[model samples]
Target: MIDYNYVLRNHILTHNQIGNASDKSNTQRCDVCGTFLSSAYALKAHLQLHSDNSKPYTCTLCDRRYSSVHSLRMHEQLHTGEKPFKCEICGKDFSLRATYKTHMFLHSGERPHKCVLCGKRFKLSSSLKMHIRTHTGEKPHNCDTCGKGFSTLGNLRRHQRIHTGEKPYKCTECGREFNQSNSLKAHMHIHTGENLPKYDISVIIYSLS
Candidate 1:
């Protein structure tokens, strides 16, 4: 029911009366500490697809409903694709400040968040939280249909695609579709010929001779 693709598209404005990201009051950055917030927020919004409870805030342009005004303001950025945060090391642009800060750790080689159980390190605390679930056997998210459990809300949503049959990832070259982004990436190598293995058969034939 939620036309996610429609809401995400770049909309052309007819007039300059509408506000842009330049206005801090209109579009402020999301909280950096809410690592799982986007996923949890999306899952809750997805629930609204089956319920009568409308989201508190809706996009002025797209009319896509969101739980909060902060979320609504954040969604407005998608219309213009304006990334305020930029990485100095890699010259990469990010929509969220938290993601930009986390990316800096990759260049700095600083794994501040470490798993207390297995001693594995992570750049993001949310990743460490999900990793800890592996040792504790804690799967907080569950499927309503099959009752299958997943540690993170993201994994649960991806699994729900099995029931929903939603294949969002598409191959531009072959027109093939996949349920997951990684699957689409793997499929792309077939067109780019990146995954093929090279063998020096001439050397083997000469050596045998």
Candidate 2:
């Protein structure tokens, strides 16, 4: 006959040892999720679920993708009517971080994207892509209305707006109209007077130009 109490005590000690070992390891393989990741990254990603503070990457064209929840938050600026990034040339305001980064080249006169045909330099790759469409005569953005076509989806969407008059972006506070949701969200800040938390400050500064 085995000593059940002694076996239980040993099992408890073994569990504690395993727990301590897991705490010390920088990376671990999760048995439940079958994910192998660094403890810090895993913890940060895990914590994103508890609160609304986690996106770090955002797509300016659409509110469809987020690199991190922290990134999605900064993207809310587009809807809030906040233009932290300003352009010296036209005094234009940009809502997206990546757009601001692209705009910096205009002031610096740094044309990294060059045209092979005419050697024309552009500050942004997307601009270069659009310019190339002109040379290629390739209109990717097709309008369902009147079977029209455009080089950029933005142009096509704008054209479509003329027909539908549909503005999906709405401000929670004032019910303002916008093409993008980020703009509306940013507008709500005026009513709420909310500020970013300390932990998110670094992420905001890093993402914003």
Candidate 3:
């Protein structure tokens, strides 16, 4: 059902154009996939992905696959609970280097991705894409029970809980049930008497009389 060709037409055309423009005499062919590359360097780099020597390193825990040993070592951190990549600004630890780099943008106030319609900038491409949906009024995530639409999958999932009557969160003191976790925390504060100031009901009645 997915039209991958139409979706990746631009990417395919770029590679095909490069292959076509290269000299046929000097072109190198990939033995595995039969893809004609412009130079030996490109061909060699491509072959590294498919070579038998590639992906020699394997994860012992989950049996997840990786192309290189360095990749496998990085994957192992998920199981070992190691966070090597740390943000200098907030001191947040990330499991991967790419995640750490992305978090740094938040502190630097660098919004690279911009919206064409609203001229709003976002630090990440995903944030910009979500902002575009707001302008388009697009609600792709739908509730199965009520047929309600939401902008995000998380909002849709939360909406479904209303139909299911699933109250997962409960108060420890009074055993009061709440649909949301934040509501439960607020309810707990009522018992703790932390937020609200105590008021005399008799004082208002006496004043009125």
Model 1 agreement with the true structure over 1-209: per-residue lDDT tens digits = 98653443212111111212243333222243221212344445445554535676777788788877777767788787989999987899988677788999989999998765457999999888788677656576779989897889999999999999999998899787887776666666678877523335442232223
Kindly report the root-mean-square deviation of model 1 from the true structure over all alpha carbons: 18.4
Clashes of each: 0, 18, 0
Candidate that scores best on lDDT = 3
RMSD of each: 18.4, 24.1, 14.8
Q: What is the TM-score of each candidate against the true structure?
A: 0.47, 0.34, 0.49
What TM-score does model 1 achieve against the real structure? 0.47
For residues 148-188, could you state the per-residue lDDT of candidate 2 as single tens digits? 86878887886686588787777665656765444445555
lDDT by residue (115-154, candidate 3, tens digit) is 6655789888878767766765556666878778787787
lDDT of 2: 0.62
- Ranked by lDDT, the better of candidates 1 and 3 is 3
Candidate 2 residues lying further than 4 Å off, grouped into runs, are 1-63, 77-96, 153-209
Per-residue error at 13 for model 3, in Å? 24
Clashes of 1: 0
lDDT of 1 at 188: 69
Error at 80, model 1, angstroms: 16
